[model samples]
Target: MQQGGNPNDIFIKINALLEEAKPRFSEECCIYKVPNNIRKLNEDAYTPQVVSIGPFHHANQNLQKMEDQKRLYCRQFIERSETKNLESLVSCVQEMEEEVRSCYSDDIKLSKEEHVMLILVDSCFILEFLLRFYFLVTRGDDSILLPEQLLVHIRNDLLLVENQVPFFVLDKLYYLSFPSTLNGEDLHNHPPLLSLTCYILPGFMISEDNFVLLSVSSDVDFGRIAHFVDLTRKLLLKSSKLFQLSTSDCSREAQVTHIYSASELNELGVKFEVNKNTECLLDITLSGHTLRIPFIRVHDWTELVLRNLLAFEQCHCIHESYLTDYTLFLDFLINTDKDVDLLIKKGIIENWLGDSNAVAKMFNGLAANTVTPDFNVQYSNIFKDLNAFCAHPWNKKVATLKRDYCNTPWKTVASIAAIFLLILTIIQTIFSILQVVH
Candidate 1:
């Protein structure tokens, strides 16, 4: 107690500070900084390699080279959009500045003008890029398709959880850029922004078959989508029936204690099969002795995509946790490179990453810092069924026999021959005893 100030004045100042410190979390805030614990595992996965989309990495000096490209795209968007001018696009973003600001979890340090400008430039760049990709795919235009690697990087950067603008911003800009009538009627009648986005990001699709399903799926409600990452997730969920199935018997409080690895399960007579019918990667199912997993192609981008999706789930959608659950489910099944090998043999995993060990490590590392609800886990039923199947006495005995003597054909033959010789000796001894008695 320094004597000069009144205690009540000091307490009043402290209360003012506490009021300022109150949490500013908004219901609309969806984009988030990747949790430090998760980011520390592989920072590169959650970071933008080529370009920064929003305020998160906008100031990164490394990404400054793409700033010119973004401005050029913004210019092109204005020129080709045939809207009044740049003012029109600026006005659009300016109107939504507050809403846009609320979408970010962290306090954006940029001034209001700077923040609005950032969104405008980044949003236009994305729209222009997606439009270029759409023309390249639809109209055989190869102008922007050159240097394919850069395109891939930008596509990936757009999907990062931190590198995002609200999807509605893009939607508004798209409509403004290409009003009802502009040029060729055939190409002018382009698919909606969501559909175009799906088309541009084919790497995230479960399969080539699902490409059309995702592009044309009417079930995806565009209004609910928060950003590009969320759009991709929603499209995937639209095609999946994993949670729609009834799990009435499974307790909501059930927690997955343990599950046998792929190799161990195989030894216990559990078969692995690729489910060819579904386009949803998360639509894995276990039928009796067979486990059906969708074919997943694991290339360089796979880990990056998965890590960002996991981060997004951890940050914004902890309650939903569909991607998190699916990832952890895979993590449970894949304990070692041998598990990766088993899945590869079953055609369940297409390991374009070349090393099975890397794939196994990637899956194993993805669940780090993730929390799955002990109650109502999406894979709780699967976990229970798999444990029950492996626990059966018959399965355990079969596994033991397979491990001990019947693993190889030569060993199996040798065991059978030994059994036959034992039976013959026993019979011979009995006959000798009977003859002696007679």
Candidate 2:
């Protein structure tokens, strides 16, 4: 007992504990596991299916099948990078281990060697894959992405929360592979890092028409990127000034509350039109009684992608949570299956899901545990305008009449005829009253 309680040993243990308590590295904090509370809503959305790029899901048995494949790609990448010394590459990557570790919110459970191996293997695979895949597409030979379905799954896996490697790691490997000494101009003239990603994935096109989707600034620092998900988000919300939180700066004022569904808005004679403008997916403009919304394709992958995006906003970027706000806006717009059907009919929502009810459930489900901030400038004007329009007694009566009677062509004709007769009767009564006065 006396030996175990020695004063010198106790002081040494105390010092070690204190040393571990402080934050260790100065790297920008990003790339996190979906918070457990948020992930619980839809665990499948956050989990990877085909590949695990980082340590979060490295131990998962399901993705172990791809580990050997990852090594194969790693070998190919080393050869392509023309790396003279594999040991130097390892050392370079290892040098940033503390910085890389600081990027993730979770304490990486992998040992130093294992973590470094993960970064090297994964970063090489992604860089090699993106470059080769882009080259294939530009050359009009998609045999690399052929057998289509597998490519689809891989594309889907890359955007999953658990299937991300930090952008820094990827950048290091990329520059090392294609060194800058002889290729300085290539760095400035190279297509966006997202070009291959966009080309591989649907909904994004690298056309001049959609510069917002493919326009990657050469001057923008790659180190600023958290992961693939962050890049995707940056593309989607191209204008941060609009959705970023502001109180005094917001010109559009609104209360944080739900509005009528798409069906209700339709009955109110508020037309829902597909947005022709390609500014942003969440850019919803309400001009007079018409709500112009960009069409969003809903497929098997849509739910997972949207949920993870929302989760990322919740965990890291709560103040600038445009995706969450957009989902909440949609939740209000789509309260029921009837609302979903209304949007589908109007081309505002391209629902590829098997059941319309599932789309309804998803939109409604997205708002779970969300507390909408009142002064969301991007949508506040739209919300306020809609509410003011809906609040008028005349609009409510017209909507009620349309839902109750003016549903069919025959009913609409009958309503017009009845109104005409009522007007004619009033005119006739006025003429009789004038005759009596004369």
Candidate 3:
């Protein structure tokens, strides 16, 4: 095996298998749940459920307000399902949402936005779980259709929702949005106990950094979310400005480009200049297509991209790992030099990338097992592709700039260490001079 080559190769093979496996599975094979609090089914083997908060509310206002008014709702969806098919999982939840809505009196006066938001919040957990499952199956695959399929799934599901709802009301709900409040904890660290649930569409984004991560499909698109999480970490590590600019610019152009589904409507990708004129272009590769969106700033596009994402937190998930891994991937890619070249040349650097230490601590909180080396192997393959892309002279220059100038605050902390040491020595000399004079 050539350094990271074995793992890379293994990941590629596994990814290929996952692609074949996904469509074969059905929603009937998956089951999910939603609850007000963390529920434990087993005492010995406990799984900390991944939960999310959005702008809408279905049940339990106290828990909702305690987090953030802007948090649409705490979405707890399917983190793990016996069925691997994300489409199947989404289908089940959509059925459940329709059932619940139909059970209510037809006379119950509910606005279209209110009804959809309610459905979205209820299904939130399921969407989360489905997305997680997709992540688990396709983690190492790097399959292009992963994100594309996810987008199509979201579009189809939304069409179903539209089919079920009164068209006039659905139209009003589509445009209705509220201002987001940034009050909340980093629940990414603290895993909650919850059941498989899915949220109705509560569309919004983290407007600042433009790291858009919303599930527009009741069926979660694991590939796109993972990519988004990775992209976000890069932005957060880079100057928040660069992250915002790159993503926003790409998003604006993306809107003008192709959008086969709502998920594609929120395509996320990395964009950089290939020439001296800094001819900016959008790489929507992560969006699951090879088409390059030209004539837009990657930065400005992220805002629109992320904004579209926020418009649909309609997907589902159950495991914190799904979201956390996505976050960790982002952090690792952004904070460390673990891109295509570094991984290809040096292979995997265990415990060097991302906030692995912090993630480890977080895992401890869940009493979870350490991530296996096998998992690392898969990620190494992703770096292989990245390395190939970066091997280009222009990409090399951009990567270098990202490494030195665009990293997060923690990476920059090393620069201050020497300054601190210099200050300490100066203070000691001053003390020595004062004592001798006295």
Q: Give the runs in model 3 whose Cα sits over 4 Å from its true position.
A: 1-172, 176-360, 366-438
1-438 per-residue lDDT for model 2 (tens digits):
343688888999999999889663234667777767777888888888778888889889998877786787677668766455678679889998888888877788888998898898888777767866666533243333655776677777888766787787777766665675236546433344645455544353123335432364433346666887787676665433354222344333455666788888888878999977754677788889999987787888788778877777776777667788788889889988889998899887877886889999998888697654543665877787898899999998988999777999999999999999999999999999999999
Distance from true location, Cα of 171 in model 3, Å:
6.2
lDDT preference between candidates 1 and 2, better one: 1
lDDT of 1: 0.81
TM-score per candidate, chains pooled: 0.90, 0.84, 0.21
Can you write out model 1's per-residue Cα lDDT over 1-438, one digit (the tens) per residue?
A: 655888899999999998889466799999999989999999899889999999999999999988988988777777777564788888889999999999999999999999999999999888878877777643233333577798788888988999999998988887777775324344454556765775545365544457566566455666778998887777676677664322342234556566888999999999999998787888888888889998888889888888888898888877666787788788889999999999999999999989999999999999988987753444677778888999999999999988998889999999899889999999999999999999
Per-residue lDDT for 166 in model 1?
A: 94
Clashes of each: 0, 0, 80
CA lDDT scores, all candidates in order: 0.81, 0.73, 0.30
| Model 1 stretches with alpha carbons more than 4 Å out | 1-4, 137-144, 181-189, 202-204, 214-217, 244-253, 375-378, 423-438
